[model samples]
Target: MVMEIVCPAGTPAALRAAVRAGAHTVYCGFNDETNARNFPGLNFDRSEMREGVDFAHAHGARVLVAINTFPRAGDQSIWHRAIDDAKLSGADAVILADAGLLDYAARTHPGLRLHLSVQAAAANADIINFYAGTFGVKRVVLPRVLSVPEIAAINAETDVETEVFVFGGLCVMAEGRCSLSSYATGLSPNMNGVCSPASHVKYHDNNGELDAKLGGFTIHRAAKDEPAPYPTLCKGCFSAGGQTGHLFEDPVSLNAEQLIPQLQKAGVRALKIEGRQRSKSYVAQVVRNFRAAVDALEAGRPLPEGMLARLSEGQAMTTGAYKKTWR
Candidate 1:
């Protein structure tokens, strides 16, 4: 079967653009602290989600609500209500990472489908199966740490459908558990659904060169004419282990468009595109490109030629751990 292409929609316009560009599903979050990628002027209000769902459904695409962040202590109600509202808004399913929130939804909204978000970092089969059995999760978004063979091994051990990221930003640390951003910016993705938030970034000139700093730490610098990548903590240059470089990962975005066949053969049920903060044009272009790739693959044709490299971060891309070089 052809794998499902799930794209991110930060706005109603992006949602419509993804649908029109041939996304099988578009996932998004509420404009609150309840979901990751909680950036300014992005995400959907309840009304926007409802309208976005209507538009997607009208075009034969599905909407998946992402209530993925862990709830604050003594404040689980907000996350719970986001799930309820997503269902009320006619979302096909809700992506969740917290065990308590998953349990609550399993009990309160028994009929609703649950997809374990990548934020959970349930990489191994033991933990993946545990989540599947514990919360009745229908799908699992594997963390970017697994190789294709490792993913195939996990599929051999579990019945849970798997999803993997195929494009956009890369995280060097496990998605949900990283504190590098919080240690520097004082906002936690676990509690606040934000990482290296734009509000705390500053751009300045240092000795005739441009530098982008995040939370007072110099992340990326460029010569006067070179493009400076965004100051995301994971993609930043830092000295560690006597290496003055992007110790975790270079400032390269994930562009695994070439790995579609291996992933399909490995039993991945869906392909996820990161970047809810992207423009509608970007979202549409990515969806269209991936759609064409998947279509050509389904037709048993060679995967399309290189098309998305120019759109990548720092104009460079990597297949992440899917190819085992990072492992």
Candidate 2:
């Protein structure tokens, strides 16, 4: 079977574009704090979400609402309302991470399908099966920390559907469990659905050097003519042992298009692209390429090579943890 192409839709236009471009599934979040990728001018408003869902359904595509952020104490109502609105909007599923919110969704909206978000970090078969057996999660977006052999092993052990990120930005730390952003900007990705928010980012021209700063800390210092990278905490440059460099992870994007066959062999049910903040054109291009590749794979044709290299961050791509050597 062709692997399902799950694309990101930050707006109604992107939603329509992905569906038209042949996406099997498109995932997005509410404009509020309920979803990750809660950047300024991104995500769907309530009305847009309803319309977007209708459009996707009409085009024979599935829409998954990402209400995956962890809810704050005494403010669980907001997350609950998100789940309620998603079901009303005719979402195919609600991707969730928090235990409390998952329980609420499973109990309150018994008919709604639930997916375990990568932020939940259900890396092993035991925990993945735990979420499935306990809350009835139908699918789990595995974290970007497992090798292909590991993923195949997990699939061999569980009956739940698995989704893996194949392209766009990469995360170094475990999803939904990183505290680096919170410590730097006081805005948690797990809470606010934002990491290294624009409110806390600043750029300075230091004479002949350009410095990118996040939360008053210099992340990268580039020459005047060089392009400055985004100051995300995990991908930032730092000094720990007299060596100043990307201490955690370099600013490289994941481009695993070449491994589509391997992932399919590993029993992956879907392939996900990771840029909800990207432009509609970029989303369309990515969706088309991935859709074509998977279609070719299903037909026993040669997979396209280097079709998305120009779209990779800094023109650098990695297989991430899909290969054990990356560990």
What lDDT tens digits, residue by residue, belong to model 1 across residues 1-327? 888999999999999999999999999999999999799999999999999999999999999999999999999999989999999999999999999999999999999999999999998899988988988999999999899999999999999999999999888887789888898899977789888888989989888688889998988787877767668888887777886887667888898899999999999999999989889988988999999999999999998876887777878888889998744
After superposing candidate 2 on the true structure, give the runs of residues whose Cα lies further than 4 Å from its correct spot. 205-208
RMSD of 2: 1.4
| Span of 10 residues, lowest total lDDT, candidate 1 | 221-230
In order, the Cα lDDT scores of the candidates are 0.91, 0.92
lDDT of 2 at 70: 93
- Minimum summed lDDT over a 10-residue window in model 2 is located at 222-231
Across residues 1-327, which tens digit of lDDT does each residue of candidate 2 receive?
779999999988999999999999999999989998999999999999999999999999999999999998999999999999999999999999999999999999999999999999999999999999999999999999899999999999999999999999888777887788899899978899998888898988889787888888988887877556767888887887888888888888898999999999999999999999888999999999999999999999999765787777756789989987835
